[model samples]
Target: MTLRVMVAYATKYGSTAEIAELVAATLRDEGIEAAAAPASRVADVRPYDAVILGSALYMGRWRRDARHFARRHRRALRERAVWVFSSGPLDPSASERDIEPVPSARRAMCRIHAREHVTFGGRLEAGAKGRMAKMILEEDRGGDFRDFDAITKWATATAGEIIALRAEL
Candidate 1:
C-alpha cells in the first residue's frame, strides 16, 4: 500500500514552508507519497496515512495557525502516525541548544501522542519583511542556520518509521 503523508507547516516568511517542502520531497524520495501544504489551508487530515507537522517558532511559541491546526486535528492525528518539528533557531551549533517548544505546543503534541518532535535550525533573511524576521536578522549570530542535510536525514527516518508502522497495521 502506498503511504500518503501530509507535510503541513506554518511559516511567517516562507522559510518553514520551504523546509516543509524539502521534507515532503525527501519523503517522496524514500518512496512515500507526500505533499506539503500550509497548516491553515489543510482542512482535513483524514485523507493521509501519516502527518508531519512543523511550525516556525517565534519567542518560543509556534505560529498561531499551526497551533490551531494541531488543536483542530488532534483527534484524527491521534489515530495515525504523527510527527512534529519546530523550526527557528538561529544557532547552528546543535539542534538541542535551540529553544524549546512552548508549553502549550508541547501539550498539544502530547494530546496527539506524536511519535517524536524534532527541532531544526531556522533561517533568517535580512530582507524578510516580517517584524520578527527583521529582528532576528539583526542578531549577531544570524544567517541561514538551516541544516538541510539534517532535515533530509530526519525525513528519511520518519519515512522509514511510517513504513514500519504501515507493516504493523
Candidate 2:
C-alpha cells in the first residue's frame, strides 16, 4: 500500500504554508502520496497514514489553530507516525540553530510522541504583515531565510521512514 501523508500547516503571512507545500512536494517526489493543507481547513486526519504538522512561530508560540489541530486530533495522531515543524526567526542574521518549536508545540508533540520535530528558517515579505504583526515586524529584517535544501532533505528522510514502515507491515 502507498503511504498517505498529510502536511498540514498554520501560517502567518504564508511563509510556513509554503514550507508545508515544499515538504509535501518533496514527499511526493520520493514516491509517497502526500497532500498539503492549512491546519484549520484539514478537518480530518483519518485518511492519512502519517502526518507532518507545521506552524509559524510567533511570540514563542504556535498559531492557535495549529495547537487546536493537534489537540483535536491527539488520539489519531498518537496512533500514526507524526512529525512536527516550526518556521520562524525571520531576522536574516539569526542562526537557524536558535530556532525550535516553542513549549506549546513541544507539549503537543509529546502527546503524539512525534517521530521528529524540526525548526526551519522562515521568510518575511515586504508588506505581508498584519496590524498586529507590526511590532514583531519591527524586529524582522525582512528576508527569505527558509532553507529549501534542508526542508527537502528532511522530507526525503521522512519518506524513507514511511516506506520502511510500510514494508514492515
After best superposition, candidate 2 residue 105: deviation in angstroms?
0.9
> What is the per-residue lDDT of model 2 for residues 1-169, given as tens digits with 9 covering 90 to 100?
7789999999888999999999999999999999999999998899999999999988789899889999999999988999999988776433446455689999989987898888888787677657646655676656788888888988999899988888887
What TM-score, computed on C-alpha atoms, does each candidate reach? 0.92, 0.91
Against the reference, the lDDT scores of all candidates come to 0.87, 0.86
Q: Pairing residues by index, what is the TM-score of model 2?
A: 0.91
| Clash list (residue pairs), candidate 2 | none
Model 2 worst lDDT window (10 residues): 91-100
Cα TM-score of candidate 1: 0.92
Candidate 1 residues 1-169, lDDT tens each?
Answer: 7999999999987889999999999999999999999999999999999999999888788899888998999999999899999888878754556455667569868988888888888877667776666776676556777889889999999999999999998
